[model samples]
Target: MHWIKTLKYYLKSLGPGFIIASVVLGPGSITVSSRIGSEHGYAFLWVILLAAISMVIYTSMGSRFGVSNKDSILQSIAGNYGRWFSAVIGIAAFLAASSFQFGNNLGVGIAMEGITGVDERVWPLIFTPLAIVLLFWAKNLYKLLEKLMMVLVMVMIVAFFFNLVLTKPDVGEIAKGFVPSSFSFDSLDIIAALVGTTFVLHGALYQSYLAQKRGWKVGDIKKGLSDSYTGISLLALISVLIIITSASALYPNGITVNSAADMALQLEALFGSYAKVIFSIGLCSAAFSSLMVNAVMGGGLLADGLGLGSTMDEKMPKIFTTIALLMGMLIAVFFRGNIIYTLILAQASSILAVPLIAIGMFLILNNKKVMGKLKNNLWQNVLAVFGFLLISIMVYFMYGKIITYIQSLS
Candidate 1:
C-alpha cells in the first residue's frame, strides 16, 4: 500500500514538466535542430544546451510566481502596466500565437505526407477535427496524455540515438559548438532559431497556468521547481539530440533540408524510409500536444482578460479548442504561399517577447513587497539579466537578416 501511494505521488508530480516538454518538442524545435544538424553538424549541439538552461530559468520563474503567490505573471504584469496595456498584449499574443499554430500544424501535416506519401492538403483537414477533440477531452485527463507523450519522447530518443550511434559523430567537433565562434549570416540565423526558441512564451506560460491548475501551493514550491527543472532538462536533451542526429547524418553529405519533410527524407538515408514513419509518429504527438496546450492557454487568457476566470464552464474548453483549430487551419489554407513569412512569425514571436517577459518577472520577483523574504537573490538576478541580454542580441541580429531578406526580394 505504501508503494502504491508513492507511485501515485510520483505520477502526480510529473504533470508540470510533461506539459513544458510537450510544447518544447513541437515544430520550432524539430526544424531548428534538424537544420543545425544538417548545416553545422554536431557543432550546434551546444546551442540547445545553452537554450535549455535559459528555458529552465524562464519556466522556473513562472512556476515560482504561480505556486508561491497564487497569482500568474500576467496578472502581475497587468497590475504594473495597467489593464489596457495588458489587454493589448493579450490580443496581440493571441493573434500571433494563432498564426504561429497554423504553421506548426501545417508543418506536422506536411511531415506526415512526406513520411506517408499522402496529399499534404488533405492531411490538415483530417487533423483539424482530431486536434480539437483532443484539446478538450478533459483537463484532468491530460495526465494520461502526458504519460503517452513521455513514451513518444522515449521512442524518439531511441530512434535518434540509435542512428547517431551507428554514425559515430565526432565528439571533438561537437565540443567546438560550445565555444563562441565568428558568426556569419547563415550561422547567425541558425543560432537565432536555436536560442530564439527559449524566448517563446507558450512553454513558460503553460508552466505558470499548469502550476495554478494543479492546486500547487506555497508549500509545494520545492516540488514545483523540481518538476519544472526536469521538464526543461528533458526538453533541452531532446533539442541537443535532434541537432546531433541531423548534423551527423546530413552535414557531411552536403544535403540541404529547408523543411521538416526534407529532414525526414534525409533521415531516410540514415534510418531508412521507416525514418519518416518514426518522425511522423513523433511529429503527430508533438503537434497535437502543443495544440492542446495552446488551446488551453489562449482560452484561459481570453477568459482572464474578460474577468471571467471562474465563469469558464465545461463548454468553454471545447469552444476554445474549436476556435484555435479553425484559426490554425484558415492560416494554413490562405497563407500557404509564403512559408518564409509563417516561419518568421513563429520564431519572431518568442524572440520579441522574451526580453519583456524577463524584465517583468525580474521586477516582480525582486519586489520585496510582493515576494517578501522569497525574492530572488543576487545570483538569480544575474542569471536572469544575462538571459535577457542573450535573447536581445539574437533578436537584433535576426531582425536585421529578415529586413535584408525582404529588401532583396523587393
Candidate 2:
C-alpha cells in the first residue's frame, strides 16, 4: 500500500516531464529516427542511450533551477551573470524555437494531407489559428499545456509502438545495436541528427519553467527526478521503437522515406492501407503537439528575456506566444519546403544559441551561490562536461555544412 501511494505521488508529479517528452518526440524526431533506422539498420542505437544520459543530466539541472529559485531562469541568470548574457540565451532560444516552428506547421499539414488527401497547405491555415486561440484563451495556460502534452505524448507512444509491433523486430538484433559498432565518416550525418534531436537543450531548458509551473519546491526534487526519468525514458522508448520499426520494415528492401508521412504511405505496400492511417495519426499527433508547444516555449522565454514577464497567465507571454505561432505559420505557408528548411533550422540553432543554452544550466547548477545545496554532484559535472564536448564536435561538422548550404543559396 505504501509503495502504491508512492507510485501515485510520482504519477501526480508528471506534467512537466510530459511537456519535455512531447516536444522532443516531435515530427522532426520521427523523420530523423526513421532515416537512421532505415539506412543504418539500428547500427547507431547507442547514440540514443548516450543522448538520454545527457538529456537526463541537463533536465535535472533545469528541474533543480526551477525549484531552487523563485524567479524565472532568465531572471536568475540576469542577477548572477548579468542581463546581457541571459538575454542572449533568451533570444537564441526564441529564434531556435521559431525556426523549428516552420517544420511543425508543415508537418501537421503533411500528416493530415497523407490521410485525407486534403491538400497539405490548407491544414496549416486552419490549425495555426486554432493553436493561437487555445494559446491565448485557455485559462491556467500552464496546466492546460501540461495536460495537453500528456495526452499527446501518450498518443505518440501508442502510435509509434503500434508501428513497432507491426515490424516484428528481432529482439536480439535490437539489443546488439546498443553495443556501438564502428562506422565510417559517411555515418556522421545520421549520428549528428540522432544527437541533435534527442539531447535537445531547448526542451531541457524548458524543464525549469515547467517545474516552476508545477509549483515544485526543494522537497519535490525527488518527484522532479522521477518525472525526468519517466519523460526521457518515454522519449528513448519512442525513438528506439521508431528506429526498429523502420529498420525492420524498410532497411531490408532499401526503402528510405523522404518524410515521416512518406514512411506511413509506403508502409501501406507492406502491411495494409490501415497501417498508413495509423502511422499518419501518430505523425499528426507529433506535429500538432509540437506546433502548439514550440510557440509557447519560444514566446514565454523571449517575453521573460525582454523583461516583459514569465508566467503564462500574464499578457506578455501569450502575446509573444502568438507571435511565434504566427511566425511559424507564415514561414511554412510561404516557403512550403520541408527537408532543406529543417536542416537549416537545426544548424542555425546549434550555431546561434544551443551551445550557450547547454552550458548555461550546467554553470547555474554548479554555482554554489545560485544552486546552494542543490548544486550538481561530481558525476553530474563529469557527464555535463562530456555532453558539452560531444555537442562541440557536433557543431564543428554542422558549421562546415552550413557554410556549404549558404554558398549554394547565393
Candidate 3:
C-alpha cells in the first residue's frame, strides 16, 4: 500500500515541477555552465550549487500562490492590478521569452551540426520547422508538454553520465569549488551570467498556474514541497556534471566557448571526436526540454490573460498551441547572434519584475477574503520578503549596467 501511494504521488506531481525543471535546462544554463568550466574550471562550481538551492526555495513560494489561491499569478494580477498592468507584463514577458526560443533554436541547430559534421547554417532551417511540428501536434496542453519534458529528462541524464565518464575528472578539485571565496570583479560577469542562467523567469511564473491547473490545494503543501525539491535536485545534478566535464578537460587548455557547439568542440578536444556526439545528444535534450516548457508557458499566459479557465475545450487548446508554435518559429528564424547579451538582458529584466510580483502575491495570500485560513505563516512571509529585497538589489545592479551601456552608446 505504501509503495502504491508513493507511485500515485509521483504521478500526481508530474506536470508542474517537471515543466519548471525542463525550462531550467535551456541554452542559458548550458552555455553559462560550459563557460564557467572553460574559464575557472572547478572553482565556480559552488555558484551552481547555491543557485539550485535558491531555486528550490523560490520555486516553492511561487507554486504556493496557486495551491493556496486557486488562481494563476497572471490571473491574480489581472484581478487586483487591472488589465492594463497585466497586459504590460504579458507583452514584456512574451517578447523576453520569445528571444529565448530563438536562442534555444539556434543552440539546438548548432549542437546537431557538431555531431553530424555539417554546416551550422543548415541546422536552423531543419530544427525550427521540426520543433514547430512537435509543439503543434501537442496542442500546448501543460500535461502533454510536461510528459515530453520528462522524456527529455531521461535522455539528458543518460547523456550527462556518459559525458562524465568520458571526462574522468579529478574529484579533489571539484570539492574545492564549494568553499566560498572572496568576490573579484574579473569573475563578477561570469557570476552574474551563472545567476541569470539558473533563475529562469518563464519557469517560475508558469509554475503557479501549473499547480492550480493540476488541482493542487493548499492542503497539498507537503506534496508540492516534495515535488519542488525533486525538480531542483535534478537541475543541480545536471549543472554539476556540465561544470565538471568542461572544467576537467577544457579549462586547462584555455578553450572558452560562447555556445553549445563550442562546448562540443571542447569536449572533442578532451575525449575524441565522439565526445562531440555525446555533447550533441545532451544539448539537443536540453534545448528540447526548454522549448517544450516555454511553448506551454507562453500559451497559458495568453489564454489566462484572455479570461480562459483551467479547463478549456478542445478547440481552444488547439488555437493556443498553434499561436505559440508560430510565435516560437518566427523568433527562431529571426534570432541571430549575441546569445550571451540576450540572456543577460532577459534575466536582468526579470529580476526587475520579481519584486513587484512577490509583494503582490504576499498581499493576496494574506488577504482574509482571498485565502482566509490559508494565509501565509510567519516563515512564508519572511521568505517572500527576503526574495523581494534580494531581487530588488540585483535588479538595481543590472539596471545600472544597462543604463551605463546606453549612455556610452549615445
Q: lDDT of each model, Cα atoms only?
A: 0.67, 0.82, 0.68
Considering lDDT, where higher is better, how would the candidates rank from best to worst? 2, 3, 1
Instruction: Give each model a TM-score.
Output: 0.87, 0.95, 0.85
Q: Which residue pairs come into collision in candidate 1?
A: 37-247
- Candidate 2, 1-410: lDDT as tens digits: 99999888777779888888877777777888887788789789999999899998888889988988898888888788888877888888887787667778777888898899998889889999999889778877778888888888898889888888888998898998998884567766677778866787878889999998888999999989889988988988888989999999999999987777778877888989888888888889888888888888888888887778887788898888899888878877877344744643463344345788876777778889888999999998999998888777777777777677668777
Decreasing TM-score order of the candidates: 2, 1, 3
Worst 10 residues of 1 by lDDT: 305-314
> Backbone collision count in every prediction?
1, 0, 0
Q: What TM-score number comes out for model 2?
A: 0.95
Lowest-sum lDDT 10-residue window in model 2: 343-352
After superposition on all CA atoms, how large is the RMSD of candidate 3? 3.4
Clashes in candidate 1: how many?
Answer: 1
List candidate 2 segments past 4 Å from native: 1-7, 336-352
